[model samples]
Target: MIVFTLLGFMCATVVGIIRIRDLFSVVMLTGMFSLLGAAIYVVMDAVDVAFTEAAVGAGVSTVLMLGTLALTSREEKTTGSSRAVSGGLIALVTGVILIYGTLDMPSYGDPQSPIHNHVVPRYINQSPNEVGLPNVVTSVLASYRGYDTLGETFVIFTAAIGVIAIIGRGRRRRKKPEDQTEADT
Candidate 1:
């Protein structure tokens, strides 16, 4: 029931995100959707995924998107679009193939999984003795995938700084005090 509700909320959020009038509201809805995904992850006992989702998805993404939104006009300028029937047909076929690929995936908790044989076992035995960290996911992300983590952090930070740099600088459209005073009159 909770999972279904979460899915419904996420679907509504996706629809709203595409159709919303206000950019800020769209960003807020995206944040809400991320939070709901985090809650679902918690229910599935994926604490690390929930943490990443809450931080990057809900918090950082929303802040970054809102910052970018502030630098641009909220109202979409384009009124109409020509048909892209070829593109739409290609996308539909691709989506069907992707869905089909999911049908033959391994059942959850099968003992014969390569995860049980190959990677997970080595991590279990070698991790505690070597790194002394109980949480293997953290150790893998910080140590094994260290370069990727560094890249991801830099990407987020760069985006945030870029947003700040562009929006914080003086722009021509900024309202002068006289304009506000005249408007108030």
Candidate 2:
């Protein structure tokens, strides 16, 4: 029930984001969507994912977007309807392809699923000895998937650096004229 409610809220938030021309309101709605996603994750017993979503999705992303907004317009410029139609078509097709791709996956919590049958038992039994970590989750993330985690971290760091660079460049550009006039005086 809670999950359904959260999903509904997320859908509504998406609609709000799409219909609203105010970039600030759109950013706020995006953050709300992320928070609702985190709540759904919590209800689904994925607390780690929930924490990550809340922190990265809602928290960091919102702040970054707000910083971006500060450097730009508050309201979004209206684009041509043709561009909107094309974009919507692309999104719809991509969503269909993604949904089709997931159709072959095992159902949630299926005991005979590949992960449960092969991966889970191995991790549960051997992680303590093989990885030397008492916590299976930690062992899996740190040892078994170390490279993947590192790659994700690297990507996030690079993105953050890029955003900071862009924002800083804008600030420098805005201040250059003032600095030049002061120097002349």
lDDT of 2 by residue, 1-185 (tens): 77788889989999999899999999999999999999999998778889999999999999989988997889877874668878989999999999999999998667788877877899989998899977787888989999999998999899889977976688889899999999999
Worst 10 residues of 2 by lDDT: 76-85
lDDT: worst 10-residue window of model 1: 166-175
lDDT of 1 by residue, 47-144 (tens): 99999999989998899788778777776655554555777799899999998997887676478866679877877788888778999987788876
**How large is the C-alpha RMSD of every model relative to the true structure?**
4.9, 2.9
Q: How much lDDT does each candidate structure score?
A: 0.83, 0.89
Model 2 reaches what TM-score against the true structure?
A: 0.80
**Candidate 2: clashing pairs of residues:** none
> Among these predicted structures, which one has the highest TM-score?
2
Quickly count the clashes in candidate 1: 0
lDDT of 2: 0.89
